[model samples]
Target: MPPLSTAATPPPALRQIGAWIAGLRRADIPEPVATVVSGCIADTLGVALAGARASAGRLVAADARDTYADGPATLLAGGRLCPEGAAFANVAAAHALDFDDNCYAGFVHGSAVVVPAALAAVEAAGGSGSDLLTAVTAGTEAQYVLADAVGNGVYHAGWWTTALFGAVGAAAAAAKAGGLTEAATADALAFALCGTGGLRACFGTDAKPLLAAQAAAGGVRATRLAARGLEVPHGVIEDPRGFARLMAAGAFDGQVPATLGRYWRLLDPGIDTKAYPVCLSAHAALDAVRDLMAEERLSEADIATVRCRVPPVVAANLTYDRPVTPAEARFSLPFAVACAMRYGTLGLEHLDEAVLADPSLGAAMGRVAMAADPGWNDDPERARRAPEGAEVTVVTLRGDSFTRFCAMPRGSAARPLAAAEHAAKFRACAVLAADRVPGPAEADRLYGRLRSLDRLPTLDGLLTP
Candidate 1:
């Protein structure tokens, strides 16, 4: 294999991936695939609907109105906007709570990146429900493949893989829904590469949601530009100074198919739904805290100190172990662990300003410490591999110590949530949006429609204002 920095000509495989995404739109997606896609769609909407009333979501909505476009697509908060604006706003809303599903391949939030683009594109084209589902599957698969190709090496080089490759996945999804030709899809992909960039330093800021929104908007723009016969470099992905070369330390060595219809990666690996609102990497620590709480019957008053050992990757991304704000706490391993240990559950309420202002939570957060354990680096095969989980050791004032190791979080693929659990989560998140829609009956009706999304003739039915 050539060095990643080599200015190699565009490889045929790169174009083939783009062609493959184009082909997925025309291919027959199985019922199982459709069901999963529907689930993801419903899950994303529930998150968005809840987030629409959040501070960030409100700001995005206000901005969308200012940058007005004459289009039929509905921004999550209220009025209609152009497809790109809608995609941007919806993506921001979906991720405002950080509750969307994740793809471990590159640690990208699958639904956050793909769903908004799909919804906006499909709505703009007046596409059928089936068309929207197919495009989502294709876009999600493309994201996984690309993230797998570049995520690990890029993260190792201090890049956020989701914001980087998410543009390509979002573009691919939009292209498929917009019915772009293979060449157009390829060009759209290249356009996506030109617009791709995001930093981990912006993790705690509004920039995190903006990163998702930009990818969503940019992807739609790229596809629309491609559909208009715009030209872009064919070898943009593999060329020197291209995405893989500039953003990642490693080259793309994986065997991506030469044609678009080889295998559906969505069915192979599937998506991982999140049970918590915080970063997925912090999930293990939360689990460990939960376990210690249950086994040792530990209480805040009895606990003197909490120590967590996690993989280096998790430690690297969770730079703020003791954060001052809710957003900062979301990315803080120690803060999440401390909250889990103190409150016995980490939820939206826990992330509230009032909860964050709790003197007890702050003191507990201060007592928590995290260490990187080499033994936890168990995901050697994953693109962005990390330690398997966290080991929490809580020492009590009475000199009693309790220890628990979490290998996987509850909602992870290894321990998938049951349908009832998913429904419960949906209801819980929906409650947060009670003021927006203002009735249990309305929420139930929307939830019922989403649960049966595939049967609907059009997705527009689900977006009732």
Candidate 2:
């Protein structure tokens, strides 16, 4: 193995990566990339609007008021906050329900991190809509690169890669939008490293949203600090005591920078949009459960036991081995699979406390079991098959059994939700917000405006009370 010191040298490719992102003019960005960025933006906005009423979102919004800035930026919720605060609040809201787009390369929520940072930067800098889209694309691409470099090392080490690597990507995006030089962008990234942290243990709690929020704020702070001439180690990312080495517990791979733009991580691997709001790892099991339910036409009462075979990686993150609360159920693979089997679908309504507390659902959830498939984890080829796929088996009281396997969860990049389904999801999320905000007509209009965010001249006009 190479010495850790060997990793400290800044690869020549780093400068080239920085330059490529900085050099992208609005018109220079590909139209497909721009359109995808728009879709991500719209999806994020819908999540934010829905999350604004969530408990975590409200708390984050309140804390953000302390950092208030009288700017053109629109906070996802009703109030106005500073650029950093707005980014934090919006990102938190966007990720509150865990319904944002995920990048396969890094397994991070790309839109939640990039969209918040770009929107804040554009609003604060008085930038154009095209600038916002370009910055978002660049930021998302940067995140995927960093995530791919780390591989699954961070996850194996129990770090939430999204919050860890997301700070760097968010900082890069903000720095680009802020017109920072290559040196400045590197410095901003260094500053961001100081704020990086998140654990999978915090998944079911309000801390889940806080993870993304802190990353968003840290990104903005990094750029602002760099703009003021703050100094940071140029080789922070590659340094032994720095991000990659400290977080991944290994020497930096020389191949990371070489792959930066040679392959567009965003377009190549692309984004995975969640059909169900539960953990992405649980999606496959959910799909399998739903399949068995349909194939056997079994009612919840007829089932004796439900078992799911899943990858060890999924098993590791299913913190709620047996969940008692609605929040806990969201992270429990067993509970999610059971809910899918009994209810036939896992919708937002199913996550409600009342639904979780239902005796019938509780009984069904208790009957579900999850076991790790050593084959799935041991075989490198099979492990790469699908991050969220699983095999489900159901045993009935009549001594009959039903089984189903899912290679990819619904709404994944491989099996995307159609336009109508995406619209329905947005409408459902909008309804979550409409319940709190007055005037149903105004709320519907706001939803329409959010769907057309790319055309909006100013985000300020969208936040009317």
Candidate 3:
């Protein structure tokens, strides 16, 4: 085979990104942006602690202990490993429950992947809270901006954006925290993009969070390698045989990258905190279902049938109608809707075997039917406005039907959760891993530390058992 051609100079977008990543500081981050990122960090760590109590989380943590040599980076579950290993284990745990935050830029689980990588890198480098905040900002913007540049076509094309673009984002975090230069940071991103990819087919399986963890770990590895003078093609994102062409199907927007620092995607199309542990696609419907149930005071026996009209993406992601496992239930609209109808709310506790085997829940799941909204694609503006929105209808046994539409769920950026609600979520998750922590008081202390991440001098003992 002939020698492969390489870009003689870095793309303008890549060069700009490198400069931004190299110069980003906590002081430069906007107050609002810092607050949003801090919330994501707090939420991610809280869920990661709970996730460690999960089977997948426990297995991954164990593997990290056995496979990676000990290092300074601390796992949220409890213990130390190399930065890459720690990032991998912690991220897996954070996402194992599908409760982490989401971003619409690429329809990716941004913080679940970015925050853990930033934490691991900062801890390994003995960096301060400010460093962690800056690293997270850098990583989040890098991934979201790149996703914006390519649009969501890649995601619609059956690619898992969290794993595809998350590696590059994670690398940006690691590089920023490690104090790598602009050029090296750019190279690290390129290496990460070149090395990472995942299929959407992994959505309902353990592979989903496992690939997320692997992407994060790969990113940390890429940054360390680049810091040690490793170099890769700089314009790989726009190269003919590179990311855009191979992954995005040649759907590249050249202008999106130029808006990197000026347009903070993290704030505008902001982070979405998930109130439910299930797929984000199901949140809107669940919100609507619960609302209708409360308004009508309809018990499970009062509902006769239910139908949900959702955007194509929602219908596509929530594929399991009669889920048998916890993983499947997280991706199943039927399970989420059924649980909501039966209990008025769905939480981590509802994933227990006893809950899953409930005859009423199974019957309720059977009653729930999800179909793609015919008009979803007809109106470009509506589709853009609510890509994952849902219209839910509940029919009572008395032959009366009520319909509710939810453009966005409660924890979404448009309708954010209150501080108290966020805290409640954190405490709930922390309690799940009570055996690892002292008690509710320690969990509360940790919550305070995580929320004030920007003020902490170091992450040395913040997540310690």
Candidate 4:
């Protein structure tokens, strides 16, 4: 169903999110909200360490180092930079592999924008871990409310939600951490929203994740400018040419009155952590096929064809039937599903350069077909509840067909990974991230630090050599 049109009734306070964040406090966040904040920070930092090795990560770090001198914020694998510059590099690393956590309702990568911007602000202001948590929670909630209010129309129309709407959340985080007044925080958000947007067409290139990096950096800068007396239009969100009107292509839902802080989007319509670094859209198909392969002992040789029935939203992204590059493969159902069928799993190794040239893998990719299932989304609310739904069927050379329906992806809130499993995943990524792998003792220590970040006096120790 289409979102409520702009003709719908809306109150004057439609874009009051900044004012809301300006009023939030550490004590205001629920314990569950704080827990999600900690989990997001821990997960983002882990992925960023691994992602910092990617080409885009290196480029952003190099640029920041060349452009800005040392400062309070840590730049992950690289040396220090000014807070804004550091935010740019760190955000790049966090999103480099598209491995960061994401919320389905918000339609944004929550931590990719919030953590980098809030962390920079926290370090610059000498805030406590609780301060950091409060800032992140506020900022993430800002984006969630705004995105939900913006409706799903913008996302379906190909606007990159994180890149476009992420700055508003970033501004909220920075303002909260830096002690901006509610009015000033509101001003910062105005400037931030004005800088919105990125296109989904950039998905198969280095530009895709870099958009996230830009949003984080831009948000920090906007907050700083606002602190320095930058005044922007207060009602920009609801103005005739304003955010919801123009950016959303006039398909605004204007549900802010009903949504803002009434219930936490973080707890209710929670985010999903990834088991595979590929697109979330492909996870259900991959999971279904991988399970069938494991249970039946099916190999690439025995498999003749694989069919995946997915909703139109997911079908839109599974375009590359036979991906020729790692970037493309990350969004390809054929690549993820076929490889999982052939190898019985898809892991970090699948992202290596060798997978791109493997003829056997290419042959398997040829056997996988993805089709849009209108019936899959017949009940839109039900589809939204289990967004990863997929009907997967695998045919063998012996004319046998095995089918399974997957409604949830692994690492989702409903089907969460074990705590030990989550830590093991961090280790796997970290081993490839740094020049010297942390010893088991060091790894354990770091994990403890992340878990207790709300009490840490300073974040300075996290990235020091």
For residues 149-194, could you state the per-residue lDDT of candidate 3 as single tens digits?
A: 8899999999999999899899999999999999999889989989
Per-structure clash totals for the candidates = 2, 0, 0, 1
Which residue pairs overlap in candidate 1's backbone? 20-260, 376-387
Query: Could you tell me which 10 consecutive residues in candidate 1 have the lowest summed lDDT?
Result: 1-10
Residue 307 in model 2: lDDT: 84
Which 10-residue window of candidate 3 scores lowest in summed lDDT? 1-10
Predicted structure 1: lDDT:
0.77
CA lDDT of every candidate: 0.77, 0.76, 0.89, 0.81
Error of 1 at 50 (Å): 1.6
Per lDDT, the best of the predicted structures is: 3
RMSD of 1: 3.6
Off by over 4 Å in 1: 1-11, 25-27, 257-264, 374-388
Ranked candidates (lDDT, high to low): 3, 4, 1, 2
**Model 4: per-residue Cα lDDT over 291-376, one tens digit each:** 88889988778899999888888887667777787888888999898778667778878876788689888888889999998787
Best by TM-score: 3
lDDT per residue, candidate 1, 235-262, as tens digits? 7767777766777754775454332344
Q: Estimate the TM-score of every prediction.
A: 0.92, 0.91, 0.96, 0.94
